[model samples]
Target chain A: MCQLLGMNCATPTDINFSFRGFSQRAGITSDHSDGFGIAFFEDKACRLFVDNQSAVESPIADFIRDYPIKSRNVIAHIRKATQGKINLENSHPFVRELWGRQWIFAHNGDLHQFNPTLTGRFQPVGDTDSELAFCYLLDQLAQRFRQGHPTLQQIFDVLKEIAPKIAEHGTFNFFLSNGQALFSYATTKLHWIVREYPFKHARLIDLDMDIDFSTVTTSEDRVAVITTEPLTNNEIWQAFAPGEMILFKDGKILQQVLTTVQRLEMEKKDPSLVRKTKADPD
Target chain B: MCQLLGMNCATPTDINFSFRGFSQRAGITSDHSDGFGIAFFEDKACRLFVDNQSAVESPIADFIRDYPIKSRNVIAHIRKATQGKINLENSHPFVRELWGRQWIFAHNGDLHQFNPTLTGRFQPVGDTDSELAFCYLLDQLAQRFRQGHPTLQQIFDVLKEIAPKIAEHGTFNFFLSNGQALFSYATTKLHWIVREYPFKHARLIDLDMDIDFSTVTTSEDRVAVITTEPLTNNEIWQAFAPGEMILFKDGKILQQVLTTVQRLEMEKKDPSLVRKTKADPD
Candidate 1:
């Protein structure tokens, strides 16, 4: 078991506030104290900081908390090391370059017997099922789109086809980002919240701390935060159904999909349950 | 021009002393301060830290100085940004994964009109001639060895063929490592030194600091350092002849080669100019 955190913002935004609470789960409030990693995307490039040390005690994490790095998309993970040795190579979030864009991935749940045939284009340096799953996803993407770079929608479609298949093995809550957008799928536990205009004060559930978002943010600033567990107690966090995938871009949900199993179950209850939502026009 | 620093060690060693003086070149000692990055390799994977902020003022750099991260192979760069915009993406050293091993590269000199045909396998995230050259080299390697992973000697042979061609355009002094070994090539300026048993005191050229390596290191520890300019004032630093390439592994030179131009120049003076060296057995 691990924890995941992701942020998609309309503007370049820092994750210090959310990360402070999320990292506490690594050692203080929770027992995910194996290793931790975080990636902050600056356009197509990202600065990935990872450590085999627990985030609560890592000097890098301390620097991250002290320094504010703003990014449009960010992904972070704290590991419990279900598989793979606890080392720098096994630390999450794992990063790989695909289609000239840096892709970051982190997983929160374990997968059993999840080895997939790899074409060697994208290979995992670490021996974790999480990294293996990530590499498999990238390998499939590279094979599917052999020509030019795929658009966000095209990638989302491919992921929609692939996530459920990977989830079938076991719990498969994960976050994937390519600087432009963030895609998250949950098979077991995941939650997300959107903070936009008229932002009010929020308090951390793990620590005795609070933030007045309205004081620090402009009205145009919008941010979407996804995590295995809600970081704040005051903010309303929406839980993802057993099989749901969401694509977030510019701090808003661009598209959402349900797994075939969930869709079938929903149709059995009500035909309106299989609903599709379009992106809001900016 | 920028500054480059690299370390290859027989044992995992901390680079605090070298990095302290090397980082000073970013602002205090010299003005290659547009941005900076460093990569510390842990087996086939690495921890890459990059910042658009000058190393002299960057908090990340401060943290690096305060904390010692031990690695067997390390590559670092301080960018002056003659080719690309002064941003995070343009900062060196650049990293890309090939054959499941992370390759780290950093360049000190500028390349003029040096765009090479990319096969879409490895592409530069930023618009830098250095990164373009790196991508070009990886593309060439991927094309040459499509079947399996190439040996260190094979990669060295390929680099000998590719480095001279890229240097024809402009200065191409660079450092590259894949955790197994460190490869360096020089067009204009580069230097290296090896510290082993009977290690003596060395003083930094940039800062008024000195270290007695014999007191801190064991006899089994051997370290080879490569830099744009020698960091120490007392150590004997060997200058790389123009168009010279050297491969270092386990803190010792494994092989060395001179470009045809340099070989011809040396042969004109002495017939025994073309020489080859083999790795020393432990």
Candidate 2:
């Protein structure tokens, strides 16, 4: 098991406050102390930092806490080594280049026998099943749009088709981005919160620290945070139901889809569920 | 133009002492301060740190100087932005994965009209002649060895054949590594120094810093450093001739090759240059 943290913002913002609480799971509040990694996207470029040491003790993590690297899209992970050994190659938040842009991915759950064919250029350097899944996703995307780059909506449609299939093997909660939009899928546990105008004070769940958003943020600033578990106690964290996929861009939801599992269950309960809700067409 | 610094060691060693003086060239000493990056190889995995900020001003660089992350192979670069914008995407050393191993590269010279056909999987993320050359080199290497990875000697042979062709376009001084060995090629300025059992105190040329290798290193340890300019003033550095390529593994030279430019120049002086000296067989 691992923990994931992702952020999408309307403007470049630092995640020191959230990361402080999230890193506690590496050794303090929880036991996910195998390794840790983080990726921050600045336009089409990415800055990735990974280490085999626990985030709580790594000097790199300490530097990250002190350096406020501003980015619009960021993904981070603290690993427990469910599949691969504890090494730099097996650290989470892996990055790859696609369509002349950097893509970052991090997973929070384990999969059983989840091997996929890797016939494309994208290949995992590590032995983690999570990395293999990331490579497979990138390969499928590259296969579908072979000519050049695609729009965000087109990517969302393709990901909606593949997320459920990968989730069928076991738990599959993941966050993916390409310096453009953030796509999050939940099979077991995930939560998200949007902070915008009229921001108030918030306290961390793991640490005895608090922040007054009003003092540091402008009214035009908007931020969306997604994580395996809630980082703050006072915020309105919306829990994702099993088999739910959401696309976040510019700190707002652009699209949402119900997985095959959720759709079938909804169909069994109420045959008119389709008519009651306006599902976005793929 | 930019600057390159690389180190290959028989044992895992920290490079803080050498890096301190090398980083001074980013702004304080020479002024190649558009951006900077460094890569440290831990076995097959790599930890790459890149910033659009100058190393002299970047907080990340300050952290790197303080934290001692030991590695066997390392590459560092400070860019002067000859062809690309000063942004994170254009920072070196660039990294890509092939055959389940991470390859790192950094360049120190300009390439003029150096566009090569890129029909393979490798592509340049940033718009620079340096990165394009790197992609072309990797593409040609992949083409020659399609079934699996080749030995270090085999790679050295292929590089000897391709480096001269690229050097024809413009200056092509560069450093490349795949965590196993360090390969350095010079079309212009490059220098190297090896330190072993008979260690002595060395003084930095750019800073008021000194280090006594006898105090920290064991007699069994050996290290080879390759840089655009010598980082220390007291050490005896060997200068590479124009169009010469050297491969360093385990802190020692494994193979050396003369490019077409060097061979032609040597032939002008002595037509029987090949028979006079023993050249390693391909």
Best by DockQ: 1
Clashing pairs in 1: none
lDDT of 1 by residue, B1-282 (tens): 888999999999999999999999988899878888999998887999998888899888888888899899999988775544788777888888888888999987765445567788788777777787889998999999999789999999999999888776568899999899999999889999999998899999999999999999999999999998999888899999998999999999999999853322322333242213211000
Q: Can you list the residue pairs that collide in candidate 2?
A: none
Model 2 residue runs over 4 Å out of place are A261-282, B262-282
Considering chain A alone, what is the TM-score of candidate 2?
A: 0.91
Query: DockQ for each of the predicted structures, in order?
Result: 0.59, 0.47
Model 2 C-alpha lDDT per residue in residues A70-131, reported as the tens digit of each score: 99999999988654478888887888877777889998876654556777477777777788
Q: Which lDDT tens digits does candidate 2 get at residues B1-282?
A: 888999999999999999999999989999988889999999989999999888899888888888898899999998787554788878889888777788999887765545577764677777777777788888898888887679999999999999988776567899999999999999899999999988899999999999999999998789999999999999999999998999999898888877875323332433332223221100
Give every candidate's TM-score on chain A. Answer: 0.91, 0.91
Per-model TM values vs. the true structure: 0.92, 0.91
Residue A14 of model 2: what lDDT? Answer: 99
Candidate 2's DockQ is 0.47
Interface RMSD of 2: 1.5
